[model samples]
Target: MTDAVLKIENLQTYYGKSHILHGVSMEVAEGEIVTLLGRNGAGKTTTLRSLSGLTPPREGRIEIFGNDTTRWPAYRIARLGVGYVPEGRRIFPNLTVLENLAVPMTRPGPWTVDKVLELFPNLGTRRDSWGRQLSGGEQEMLAIARALLVNPKLLLLDEPSQGLAPLLVREVFRVVASMREQGISILLVEQNARFGLEVADRVYVLNDGQMIHSGPARELAKDEERVRALAGVGGKEDGVLTAKPKTSAA
Candidate 1:
């Protein structure tokens, strides 16, 4: 448990009376990037939400650094060093980029405004720009920068590359890879199977609210047919089938 930054056992989540995630279980080891890959509405986001306490799981256990956090609230989970960047870039639209970075500094460790800016030079240039004024790519970088400011031990990213240009997606995945190099464990939920496999150390496949596959990323990448089938994409010609480019968005 100490070696794992996060561990979930048979996690189950729901939206009102509708069940969304069933018996979902996975782990992110220290300093590793673990990705959850699946088609749309395959419970990827719900898994992240449950772990982040946005929608607490109705059953199972959530352990962070070996401590039980199953019933913890969002804020509590966040304070425990879990930084969550949800599907949509949720920066404060009314605030400046700098202001947005300052909003989540609860009890900071190594992450400072200067550090965050250093990681995102684009944001540094637009330090005083309003969040709403930034482009989609810039907004995504800001969202990731803001999460890093929390100095999280475990980062939960939901669709980090949802809607972005090809180049921007590559840049985003590069940053995610850098985070792992810096010793930040990440649990990524992404639709781009190729990109996810490229950056992830391990991979888990979720379908219809349950995890159906789990293994090393390299192993899955080698079997293109299996990857395409699991992701529900048809072939290499389909842009979604092959994670050809380095880019992605949330």
Candidate 2:
């Protein structure tokens, strides 16, 4: 409890009549990179959404630094230091990179506009460019930089490498690793099991709205068969994550 930046217990959430999360529970400890891994429809994003109050849980508890925030609104959750970078790189397209970074400044401490620009040098060069003009990788960087501007204690990242090239994916994961080095706790929801394993200290797998596996990332990374089976991927070999072949529906 003392070291945990975010904690959830028996969390349940729904989207209209569709049940999304069922008794999902996990914790992100201070300065830890905890990845939530699963296949396409495994409720990984829902878990992060639930944590950030984007889709409030119908049942269970959410605590931020020991304070219960289950029923808090999204804005309130953000104020409580829960920064969420959603599935899409949802930066304001019409706004400049600098403006997008300035929009989330509530009560910032160490994360200033200049500091974030320095952290993301590419963004610094493109500060005056409209968000829509940036490339996919740059957009992803901007999304993360915008969240960091909030000076959050817990950062929620959903699919940061979803549509990136291999080189860009590596770069994105490197930034994620760097964030952990800076003492920022992160709850990353990713479909890329291999990439997630590379940066995560701890890993949890979610399936059909429930957490199926939880342990050290390295432990799971070593067991290729188990990772393939759990995450529906071809498994990592020679430091690369090969995609699993798709099968016809029976």
lDDT by residue (1-250, candidate 2, tens digit) is 4788888999999999999899999988899999998877789888888878889999999999888999988888898887889988898999999899879955657888888888889999999999999998899999998898888888899988877778888888888888877788999987777888878999999999999999999999888889878877535541233322122232
TM-score of 2: 0.92
Give residue 9's error in model 1 in angstroms: 0.8
Q: After superposition, how far is residue 108 of candidate 1 from its true place, in Å?
A: 3.2
lDDT of each: 0.85, 0.85
For all predictions, the C-alpha RMSD in Å is 3.4, 2.8
Against the true structure, what is each candidate's TM-score? 0.92, 0.92
Can you tell me which runs of candidate 2 are displaced by over 4 Å? 237-250
Off by over 4 Å in 1: 234-250
